[model samples]
Target: MKTLKCPLCGNELTSIFRMTKTGSLKNKYGCLICGWETFELRKNENLAWKDAKEFISKFPPIMRSHQGDNLKLDFEDDVLTLIGKDTSRGKLYLQNCDGDVEIATPEDVEQWPWELEQKGGSNDI
Candidate 1:
């Protein structure tokens, strides 16, 4: 997987898991250097940029590691199309926007989008 850096700290972020929730798609994200956990969900094309920018900026870059330790990436807004990476195994790790982190295999990467809908991770907050 490609090295993903935190937009706030510019430090490498680590992928913890691909969060899946009901009514939404799976979200990719990581722990921030500080400690804050960040994640984003899928959104329509029109709301993608606006929601993305708003969502990304709302959370502070994390003043302290304890407060902000992680950032989650999303594909709903086409985040995966830009920063998502295929690990060649069976999953995909992605991070983008303000900042997020994840490591996944090729298979996971390929089906992440579909899995999102199947799992209904669109309702994540």
Candidate 2:
């Protein structure tokens, strides 16, 4: 079986069983780290597998670790710029023409456009 990951946070997932009120077991894949639960069940294993695959294909890999106060990123075009950082609060300040915005960490910047440019082709974002 292929491994599944949480669609929202990109964390590892585990298969689990829960008892419904009807006293039947329903199998689901859940992410312990982010508390994401899949609604699809093993009762329809094929459909559940398809849904899981579709979910995983939608998100970027979660490569963000706690960089603490040391996180830094520099891009040449000023498309994204770091304006402030508060490691104690786990917040980062960024600014672009869209205006200033706060983020949880540097990894939150997925840079989808830059990635597409690097690949020399369009990709699903």
Candidate 3:
């Protein structure tokens, strides 16, 4: 099984179980670091897996430890392609339209995009 991650904050998601009123345990996933929680679903249920996978799929891999500025990466044809943008060659460039080009480091490549669609403004990058 693949590890689950929080879609908003990119943290490791932990599984939790709660007893429902019907006396059945429902499984849920939550991020301890960000307090992101998944909807309750019964164990051994396919929908639980589907919900977790689908929720995590919305956000791509982001630089979880970087504290610097979140560079605005460009999206291309429904894909977030950050390599060689703003007429930059050989390295990744920030697409902030500031005219002055800023080259991103290997670690910066994982930084979350500033323009990404977020829910509840939960992106703390």
RMSD of each: 16.9, 9.6, 11.6
Tell me the TM-score of each prediction against the true structure: 0.24, 0.41, 0.45
Clashing pairs in 3: 63-110
**Residue-by-residue lDDT tens digits, candidate 1, 1-125:** 22334445546555444435555444344446665334444333333333433444454322111122222333334434324332233334455455655553342333222233323234222
lDDT of 3 at 59: 50
lDDT at residue 17 of model 2 (Cα atoms): 76
Which lDDT value does model 3 have at 50?
A: 63
Backbone clashes in each candidate structure, one number apiece? 37, 0, 1
Model 2, 1-125: lDDT tens per residue? 54454655547577767778888877777789988777767665556566665666655332222221122234424445455555556566665657755454545654423232323334332
Candidate 2 residue-wise lDDT at 108: 60
Query: Cα lDDT of all candidates, in order?
Result: 0.38, 0.52, 0.52
Task: Give the Cα-based TM-score of candidate 3 against the true structure.
Answer: 0.45
lDDT of 1: 0.38
- Lowest-sum lDDT 10-residue window in model 2: 63-72
Please provide, for model 3 over 21-52, each residue's C-alpha lDDT reduced to its tens digit, 9 standing for 90 to 100: 89988887778898878776657545676677
Give the Å shift of residue 92 in candidate 3: 7.9
